[model samples]
Target chain A: MPKLLEISKPFIVLVEGKDDAEMLYSLTHSMGMPKDEFQVLQYGGKQKFPSFLKQITNFPEFEMVTKLAIFRDADENSQSAFQSIEHHLKSSDLIPQDSVPTHSGEVKKSDSGFAVGIYITPDCSNKGALETLLLDSLTSEMKSEIETYVTQAEKSLSTDRARDKYKNSTKSRTYAYSALFENASFHDTFNKRLWDWSHPTFNQLKTFLQAF
Target chain B: MPLVQSVHFSNYRNFTDFTMDGLQRINLIVGDSNVGKTGLLEGLVTLWGNEEQFKALPNTFRMSYGDYTTSLDSFWSWLHPQRNHSLTMILRSTDIDNLMRAVRYEDHVRYDRDSVERSLQKTPYKINILPIGIGNYEFQVDLFNQLANTKNGKESLVSSLQVIEPRLKGLDYLKLPSSNHAMVYADVDLDYKIPTTQFGHGFTRSMEMLSNLILSGSDIMIADEIENGIHYSALGSVWKAIIDYAVKNDVQVFATTHSRECIAAAHEAMSEQENYELNVIRLQNRKGEVVAINHNKEDIETAFDLGLPLR
Candidate 1:
């Protein structure tokens, strides 16, 4: 386990959709990363952001989280939810007013070394810009099939939207999109071709950590 | 299988007769207010609890028509003081699944002198409810030991509770709180703790169904209105636990509820469970006699359309 001097590797509280949490944990563990290193909490859906926050605050480990990340879909209410958290924290004097990020993907650090980030993106591009870019290159027939399938699965789309907004990263969205499409017929279609644009997000995550 | 699957007798207060027939893994009894939802459970309690236990109405508190009826009046029967009851449970042999193959009531014969100088004696009623052969047989133990013998050892009853727990292997320790003496196996042990007094109305009524089901090893146990006071969120888990345990122990259960959550939980359980047969009985009152409307896949949609709440 990587340690920051006497400081433990910060607990990255990832409160995302249920399937997203499951996939994240699975992906993390598959890469030899211990699940316990970052508590991957499931939010069920973005409708429960307030309750999720309240529940997480109740847990004893809430204060120990050196990095508090809010990953949700950029639904109609995502901006309000992000602002709610920032407002609540600012009012509570937990985070400096200036430190609260104004836009998605922008990192803001608190006085106590605690950091917060927001991920808000369009629903269609939830698999991130890269995966969406890859999907863009697909045949019109394939695009229509994906859209039609997604349109029918509106419930799953809402959940995917919440996740996309939370991670605030097109890269994470691409991962999610991959997961969603992994079982679909399009997986083989883009299986070999999409890596050029999509592989770098995970590689960037590794690089970012190594540099830090 | 129960010939009369569910019975709802009210207005007479203590003279409720809620019985059912041909019980399955999951049975739903639906009826209007005062139609004997709780009354049905009372009958099962009486049948499973034992004749002696039922006779000593003072000792064994009974719930009738969704309300606890503690004081015994000449409501059930005037001829027999013992039969002045609220409910009676008649179960089919096949529904039992040979889990508790034999259940023989202990002899309860006591002589008492009436004010008229007439000698009154308690008669021992012996009936083998289980089949002649099959099932993991154990000694037919009296749950209400005191009813049989005033000086019945508490340890003996406690030992019986312990004896029954291991036979039902799927029981998780987390779900069941343990006893100091032993794990309570019989219906008596489970009901002993249920605060059935009118004072503990909420506690009494809430746990009454679960308490009776656990204590009485009746294969086809019936309970009306499962989520009385328990939160709807918690009711799902409680029902799941009970259903899971029942399915594993080969116990068929019939529970009626007006709450949509309870119906949803039962429906969800049915969808997940393939082996269980879930039948919803909607009682239609015509004049004075009540007729049950059973819903199956063929007419479930129609039944739902008729406001039967078939989930």
Candidate 2:
């Protein structure tokens, strides 16, 4: 249920679910930023993003919002995910008719004078989701160990059984990597034990959020 | 119509320094439990506290928090915890100069020396009616009589009540043979007339709200937990009647609610109206100081769309 009172924040970031919101909240806190400076709204899933945008655009509180950023997972295709959001933005008249930027991760000003940024996660260059991004952020040594473990597991099973069990290389790697952190849920793997702001792996996300 | 454009207060209750701007005709106050949403309303009431209004403060408090004590000492405890500090609130409107200041000791409370003089301006329609929460049955009867006294007032009351209970035909005062005072009765379904209490909680509450809106002649109406006893489905119509009556009578309304349905209903109703202005004020305690965030009509609509939790 929506709250009756809207909490005031200059910037609002829309993510896919509570896990994404919690991760970003942890990251923001680790970077010495106050939680009240920005708000992270979970849209439940990527499919609800367009409806969420329409609602906020129609809302009176969004007028006071200076910046809005949409964060979504690339999943199977980064370009397609980016295009989907771009189409929604253009249709809503949030961006100029001819100014839909070609880059997947660039900030554009809406017609209403609010800054909007779109980011497709697990690195815009890779075809993956937030879990993919988390996997990539692991230390190189841990990454190699997880990959080797997944390979060993794949060889132990028949090719068809392995295919049935693993689904894809990303899922397999995620499972192996998750095992290292006491088999934390995909949502809980981004805790302080596994994430550090000082690590070079977080440079991109840190830079993107700091723009607000 | 006079809108309370802003309100500023210092050392009042849980608020150290608080200022809320861009108040509109209908403002809904919302926040987490115990974040001082009621305190803010009380602060507004205190700002308009005259001798007569001050005398009724205890009843208002009793209605809101169920504290039965009539002494002003209980009211003084609402001041910020810092001892010897004075509570000050300044209300800014287009044409009203309203302020309230009061200091309290362990057992006695007194208005600041200059507060009484500063609050004496005869601003037009400066009446403040604090309904607190539940409307008293006896008070509702008085208001009904006052509304019935004016031409077409009874018809207006019946018309508004029909939105909730279509069977309600009219309202009348009944003088019981056993008692001296009269009680309110609703004429429902053409022939069967029942005491107002038999019409259920919602009917009584709606009657109280409509009668008060008509008879209070108040410039400002403060309703804490305005959604109480009102059905979620009827919220839109109830708000419409409230807004319509408020606008026609030049009354500014401040209401609080923890229910999202109430807020959404108010937003939908306000949007349907041509020129009504509405704001949702969210009170929050950030780092020990109370902060008021004003969400205008558009903002509230967006919040509804995105399922943002305001409480």
Candidate 2 residue runs with Cα over 4 Å from true position: A1-69, A72-212, B62-74, B77-81, B86-121, B128-139, B150-156, B159-170, B174-201, B231-234
How far in Å is the alpha carbon of B153 misplaced in model 1? 20
TM-score of each: 0.33, 0.56
Q: After superposition, how far is residue B10 of candidate 2 from its true place, in Å?
A: 2.1
The TM-score, computed over Cα atoms with residue i paired to residue i, of candidate 1 is 0.33
Q: How many residue pairs clash in all the candidates, one count each? A: 31, 12
Candidate 1 lDDT over residue span A36-93, tens digit each:
6766555545544544453334333345666665555544454565565565555543
Q: Highest TM-score, which number?
A: 2
Give the Cα lDDT of each candidate: 0.42, 0.70
Report the TM-score of the second chain of model 1 against its true counterpart.
0.47
User: Looking at the true structure's interface, with contacts defined as alpha carbon pairs within 8 Å between chains A and B, what fraction does model 1 recover?
Assistant: 0.00
Q: How much of the true A–B contact set does each candidate keep?
A: 0.00, 0.23
TM-score of model 1's chain A:
0.52
